[model samples]
Target: NLNGNDLAATVGRVQLAKLESIIAGRRRVAARIARGLADCDGLDIGHEPEGAESVYWFLRIAVAEGAFSLSKVEIAAAVSAEGIPVNPTYRHLPAEAEWFRERKVFPPSDYPWGLPDYAGDRDAVYPCDNAVAAVESHFILSIHESWSDADVDDAVAALRKVADAYRA
Candidate 1:
């Protein structure tokens, strides 16, 4: 797929040269934030798997329904109000997507994949109750290599504040 722009190519090359260092910086910041929130209940912060290393594209947290009095939606708002760049990673798609706004049902010839001759039900429901619930409870934190230690600390503090306010 054609995805690059000529101007971006030049900048990308420069960034590529320092990619390893940038990744390291992000990891450091992520680790610090994780450690800061290690004791907090109800929050499941993202972490690197067994032997794999990540570039920290984005930081995410899962809210445990048993531990938190507030919902993921409420936590996101509380954190956002604290001036952090955190947002709910999950949301209801049919309510948010423009395509779904116009077409309430999915199936035979209703979407792009639906063909004219397809003998399928037009109002078929996609079974994904678990997936929908998971997405609705994930909170994403915006992180980057450019952020300073203070920034990470601030994010940690914001999370703690929200957790304290809504402990179950």
Candidate 2:
């Protein structure tokens, strides 16, 4: 397989050796971003759960509904306009996709769900309201191990500026 090739394996080993340092740098940047944005209204920079740690590859910022005059998309746009890279979180929900709704898997038939031993609903409606809400309300700010503290500070500033300007 391509993944097991000698060149890829050699690169992987090099990355593995520096993985700890990379993760540490990511954590430090994420923490600085969190602290800088802590006082900003209507934005939620999520926390690490008890006894858990995160490398914080993407910082998910949830904009509370009704907390701002602008929607999450607009807020993200405003941040992006300030030259900060911001994007809406996952836009597609599997439960709401056409493939899932039509049971298109395995073609022409429901397959597993249509089987006699299957106990689940064949025509299940998965509204996934919470998932939908989260997607609508959240935007992602990419964090990287190579990010300087100044970069993190700029992102926080842009977010806070947009939030403050649009607070309801």
Candidate 3:
């Protein structure tokens, strides 16, 4: 039986020691950007739920439905073009992955899509899929533990610029 890999274990131990500081840095950067964007419009900044605290690794933002004419992909592309590390993190199933492709089974006994009779509504599937809905609506901005306040400001500024330019 494999217990664990020694090197991986060692690295995990080291990272665990620094975990608190790492989380703090992430939260600090996220909070700064949150404050900067508080009064801003046309975009919805990521937020924590009532009791949950987020150590935001990638500060996620959702472009409001009517806030801009651009789609999520376009918004992500624009943000990336601005030199900020931003990406749309989610990809819808089947359309984005071959494993989910129609009528493709790895083994005859097991169809990954399951029996056709069990298949649900295809048209309504994407919107109802949580992963699809999330990716369709939001883009993620990478944040680092070492980022300065100016870095946070600059990132937020670029986002605001894109939002304003694309605003409906």
Q: Which candidate is the best by TM-score?
A: 2
Report the error of model 2 at residue 162, Å: 1.5
Judge candidate 1 at residue 19 and give its lDDT.
Answer: 92
Error of 2 at 87 (Å): 0.8
Q: Which RMSD values do the candidates have, in order?
A: 4.6, 3.0, 5.0
lDDT of 2: 0.84
Per-residue alpha-carbon lDDT of candidate 1 for residues 44-82, written as tens digits (9 for 90 to 100): 676456998777777877788767777787888899999
Task: Single out the weakest 10-residue window by summed lDDT for candidate 1.
Answer: 104-113
Off by over 4 Å in 2: 1-17, 47-49, 106-111, 114-117
lDDT by residue for model 3 (8-66), tens:
89988999999999999998998888777776676766646799998887788877777
lDDT for each candidate structure: 0.78, 0.84, 0.77
Give one digit per residue, the lDDT tens place, for model 2 in 1-168.
465988889989999999999999988988898888777879978645799898877888889889999778888888889998778676778888877888877888877678899999888897888777777778988788888878888888888889889999
- What TM-scores do the predictions have? 0.73, 0.79, 0.74
Question: Residue 117 deviation, candidate 2, in Å?
Answer: 4.5
Which of 1 and 2 is ahead in TM-score? 2
Residue 75, candidate 2: alpha-carbon lDDT: 86
Ranking by TM-score: 2, 3, 1
Q: Report the Cα lDDT for residue 110, model 1.
A: 58
What is the descending lDDT order? 2, 1, 3
Task: Give per-residue lDDT, candidate 3, residue 50.
Answer: 95
